[model samples]
Target chain A: DVKVTQSSRYLVKRTGEKVFLECVQDMDHENMFWYRQDPGLGLRLIYFSYDVKMKEKGDIPEGYSVSREKKERFSLILESASTNQTSMYLCASTLRGGQGPKEQYFGPGTRLTVT
Target chain B: DQQVKQNSPSLSVQEGRISILNCDYTNSMFDYFLWYKKYPAEGPTFLISISSIKDKNEDGRFTVFLNKSAKHLSLHIVPSQPGDSAVYFCAAMTSGSARQLTFGSGTQLTVLP
Candidate 1:
């Protein structure tokens, strides 16, 4: 089974504070993604890395950045956390050319609260 | 601006009955569709999917139906159990270089005994 682990399950941060959320995949997937799940907004992609040092912005990437120094780890950084940024964050990984929808495996998730 | 939409926010169904979840999309370019099931405090898991060439796909009690002409899709779960209760998300992706998916808000299903 593919195991995707997040650095923290729950986190609390103050406004204007820098926050880092880490994700690691044991399957060595080539694609890693960060998404924010919000009510009435589903899962919107924040950023994705196809390979080490390669990143692409998704639908809502503002105020967020990503780092992929290694293939197994992906990190999401909040430049300055704000109340509006409080939400559940999810990390997912998938093989590059796998069959059938390239199904993504995800970590448990990190619920971030920005006060 | 929401390409994929699941209008129903919640649904309640009796156990051992059918639970049908609906999804709609505005983009004709989307060629692939997927459904994901999410539990509390967990990320969404891949449930089922259908390609543009096929209309229906079934796995065990979970079946997915797609209507290309209507730009709509539906998931049918027969004899839904209490354990099946969760938030279901509908997602779509166009056939292109980037496989960034567009997802619906999601529908929460509650199965009552």
Candidate 2:
């Protein structure tokens, strides 16, 4: 079974504080992604990394950044947490090469509350 | 602009009945569609997927139907049990787009006993 684990299940941060969310996948997938789920907004991609040290901005990358120093691990960083940034963050990974759709496996998720 | 849309914010169905959830997409480039189930405080899980080449795909009690001409799709859960209740999300992606999927606002499904 593919397993994706996140560093924390829940977190609370003050405004202007830096927050870091970590994710690790055991399946050795080449592609990793970060997404935030908000009420009525669904899941919006924040950032994605296809290779080590390579990252691309997603639709909602303005307040978030990502890091992929190694293949199996990915990290999401909030330069300064704000009230508007409080939402559930998710990490997903998928294999690189495939003819059809590559379904992404997601971590349990990190619920961050910015106060 | 929302490429994918799940218009129904919520749906309620009695147990042992069929629950149909609908989704629509505006992007013609999308050739693959998927459905995901998510619970409160948990990440969404892959439920089923259908390719554009085929109009229907089924797995046990779950069946996904795709209509390319209308740019629409629906998921049918037959004999839906209480356990099947969750937020269902519709997602789509083009084959050439680095496997990035565009997701729709989810529909909350409730199965009453």
Candidate 3:
């Protein structure tokens, strides 16, 4: 089974504080992604990394940044947490290319609250 | 503009009955569609998927039907149990697009006993 684990299930941070959310996948997938889920907005991609040390901005990458130092781990960083940045963050990984569909496996999710 | 749309915000169905969740997409380039189930405080899980070449794909009690001409798809769960109650999201992606998926605003499903 493919397992994706997040660093924190719930977190509370003060405004202007830096927040870091970690994710590790055991499946050794080459592609990793960060997404935030909001009410009525669904899941919007924040950032994605296709390989180590490579990152691409997603639709909602204004307030968030990502890091991929290693293949199996990806991290999301909030330079300065704000109330509007509080949301459920999710991490997912998938194989780069294969014969079948590229289905992403997601982590449990981290709920961050900026106070 | 929302590329994918789930018209129904919520759906209620009695146990042992069929529950249908609908989704529509505006992008004609999308060739792959997927359905995901998410519970409160948890990330979405892959449920089923269908390609543009095929109209339907089934896995156990969950079946996803795709209509390329209409740019629409539906997920059918027969005899839905209480455990099936969750938010269902429909996602679409084009092949060779770095595997980025465009998801719809999910539909909350409630299964009543």
DockQ top scorer = 2
How would the candidate models be sorted by TM-score, starting from the highest?
Answer: 2, 3, 1
| TM-score (C-alpha) between model 1 and the true structure | 0.97
Model 3, span B50-74: residue lDDT tens: 9999999999999999988898999
Query: What are the Cα lDDT values of the candidates?
Result: 0.93, 0.96, 0.94
List the candidates ranked by DockQ, beginning with the highest. 2, 3, 1
- Stretches > 4 Å off in candidate 1: none
- Candidate 2 lDDT at B36 equals 98
Query: Where is the poorest 10-residue window by lDDT in model 1 chain B?
Result: B93-102
Residue B19, model 1: Cα distance from true site in angstroms = 0.3
lDDT of 1 by residue, B66-88 (tens): 99999999999997999999999
Q: In lDDT terms, which candidate is top?
A: 2
Q: Give the distance in Å from residue B24's predicted Cα in candidate 1 to where it truly belongs.
A: 0.4
| Per-residue alpha-carbon lDDT of candidate 3 for residues A6-110, written as tens digits (9 for 90 to 100) | 999999999999999999999989999999999898999999999999999999999788899999999999999999998999999999987556889999999
What's the TM-score of chain A alone for every prediction? 0.97, 0.98, 0.98
| Sliding window of 10 residues with minimal summed lDDT for model 3 chain A | A95-104
Docking level for model 1 = medium
A1-115: candidate 2 lDDT, tens digit per residue: 8899999999999999999999999998999999999989899999999999999999999988889999999999999999999999999999887799999999999999999
